[model samples]
Target: MDSSIPSISPWRLSVAPMMDWTDRHCRYFHRLLTQHTLLYTEMVTTGALRHGSVERHLRFNAEEHPVALQLGGSDAADLAFAAKLGEQWGYNEINLNCGCPSDRVQRGAFGACLMNEPPLVADGVKAMVDVVSVPVTVKHRIGIDQIESYDFVRDFVGTVKDAGCSVFIVHARNAWLQGLSPKENREIPPLRYELAYQLKKDFPSLTIAINGGITRNDQIAEHLNEVDGVMIGREAYYNPWLLTTWDAQFFNSAESSITREAVEEAMVTYMERAFKEDGCPWYAIARHMLGLYHGQRGGRLWRQVWSNHKLKPMQPREVMAVARVALAKGAEVPA
Candidate 1:
């Protein structure tokens, strides 16, 4: 029997949900770079949202629209309740996190371990979809542990798709749940993009966005030819300037990429406002902007000035002024 292909959504480019990295502050920062690229929150467990301060976990800036909330849990009821909260919080989509391989997440019986139990994942997806008006998606690995069979992921996708998940972000690597640390899982496993492409071919109706080790604009361009979308992780954070070009490069946007100076200015304004309204420390915002200069001339000096802990007490505008001066001096950076 031919599987009915689902209608794909507008998910051409997305930033992967990095724990501790892609928080609300990071998402707001990313929104300044590319208006078209979708941003995701760090995985918020159902426990945190339900038992802890719900507002703190679910709150987000209005500017971070088209953003998705990635939820981590195995319980169908918890996931459904969390999805409902995400909808209430104005998230464009609700994403199930079946990709993380951290030991902490494993203890909860969710994350990559859920990949081994397709029925449970399916139930969670169905429950979330039934209650939430927004789309429910899943991010997962190509395989789990020592399992290398393509059929493992193929069946996983089939089962969850039946439960109403049409969009999938597939990290093109097997998650070694036991021996490797979370960081090692990202680096050690060889990326098998072909597996992702093949999955797209087999499940022609599903929206398959390839993740894992994709670092360049050309790579994103190339993947879009075969799959429905592309999701970038470390590269998007460590060197976020890459995202500035995505709006024009992939979305045919006529607006040129915003100047680095403009981005810095906007962030400074945000920092000032946040501090006044919420008492946010300047360095908390500055840490995310250290890579804004990236490869530009005097970029290192500018980064150093912004990240200098001594300036933590200084206002964000003063830090911005110092960074601008450093860039103006154009000090030679070591190769």
Candidate 2:
């Protein structure tokens, strides 16, 4: 990890850009846990920006500074136009999504399908770089389908690097787009982290961040010793409490652990502000926080109580009251 890489920032920990799961609300919650971590928006298609509401797709809390917006598309012009929009809207970075393997993404002619066409990806990155002053990065898999060669990824990186992309986030697993569901695609694809480490060795100038199935703090620490950064996905979402320790453990920042009560209280304030200013429903934001108490004493009961009562036609603060009671009782919560 060269300190001189123009796009590489001081933050070495990042949240992966999950499609439906890493939305603005989720990013807000994750930001509450760690101050120095880089957060990412969910994958927003180029079509969404061109044909849909740019404001709706790109809106995020200012607290999520150094946030990267991941764009999903194959066309260079469309991607460039969308990247410009993201820059104008105040995103710190614009990341091209080249790793997703869902059938819908493939049908749209992007995602892992672009992995087989590095030239097109280069062109897309070049277009984005030409338009936006912000750094344009790429997230991709080692390979796609049955093509598991190391040269495949090396060439992919080489091609994109030639187009001025210095940052690469490798998921460390190939995408079996044909037979596997997206959930299965995440698990079934065997991780080849050694290949990612080799990539760092091969392109020492490029800032490489490895992602996929990374859960524990020790694993994050170990990978950081090799790669420039580490991106955590589902584990960060399902077991968010793990992030409470990130500032101290990863960033070497001051310890910022808050009790579950404080977290819920913060969420209560957030919900009130959202409802008053943005017309955000309680459930819309609370859905992401259901896992906040995960692995703690009385977690399940808190979830059950909130799940049953929050959906009713009531104020958001009222639902917080329910969660407060559940937490006080010390009900069993799953890890």
Candidate 3:
């Protein structure tokens, strides 16, 4: 697990597929920071793909290569059809969501609820694997509600692996099904990383990637020693600068030459192109990069300038000038 040598596994590190957060614009911005870390789209429901606009759900910048599409559904036929659509749209992998505990997903009879129905999860995984050439994976919690016994999850993995799913992303917390908002579900449950390590121990042949309560680079390295990879969620989004060092730190690549300013300029160019090509507004993309200077001296003022709706009429380049001015002004203030 020493990171001095580059990892051979594609799932060695990843950004979690958070709903409404890891959209195409966000993925495009993230791609600027770390090229090797696998990215994923928000959980696109099977019903959305079947009845909604395919382009709106599947379109992504070519730069977001190595990205995966995460699907939320329990039906075998729907999953297979959705997986085919994702593959056809140039996604590198197809992931099934069995980890989300939102009531919306519960109403659809999927997500964390599917853990109690392992055969259904297995059927969906097999159905997708049968149709897609790309790897089919699942993201799930260690246990649901009061089901803390390790056997519950171990058997779930055993059944799904038999259906040709070789990778599992384990969120090492129980998805408390009742009386908790999704945000609370992420925080209220006690993180049990050891359970994820045990999963790796039991299913040595399958790639097991752990998620939950992992933020620092040291924590990521420690988990990699026990599991194949780590999937970062909120931390990765709010403090994306953490990704700038990942290639050299985890992938063993040369340090990234990009500076915060250079990344900002690159995003500006991307914004202009997006607007001309698809009538997409620049703010849609700029919002994702507000954390580009996170933890730096001028981050707040810089973010304030970018988030200001009054600047909507200005072109992206002009807004960049204004933001840089604010950033410099903020830097003059003492800590």
Every model's TM-score: 0.95, 0.95, 0.97
What lDDT tens digits, residue by residue, belong to model 1 across residues 159-269? 999999999999999999999999999999989999999989998988999999999998998999899999999999999998888888888777655898898889988
lDDT of 2 by residue, 126-175 (tens): 99999999899999999999888999999999999999999999999999
Clashes of each: 0, 2, 0
Ranking by lDDT: 3, 1, 2
CA lDDT of 103 in candidate 3? 97
Tell me which residue pairs clash in candidate 2.
298-331, 300-333
Over the full model, what C-alpha lDDT does candidate 1 score relative to the true structure? 0.91
- Report the Cα lDDT for residue 247, model 1: 80
Worst 10 residues of 2 by lDDT: 2-11
The candidate that achieves the highest lDDT relative to the unseen native structure: 3
- Colliding pairs, model 3: none
Instruction: Give me the candidate number with maximum TM-score.
Output: 3
Candidate 2 has an lDDT of 0.89
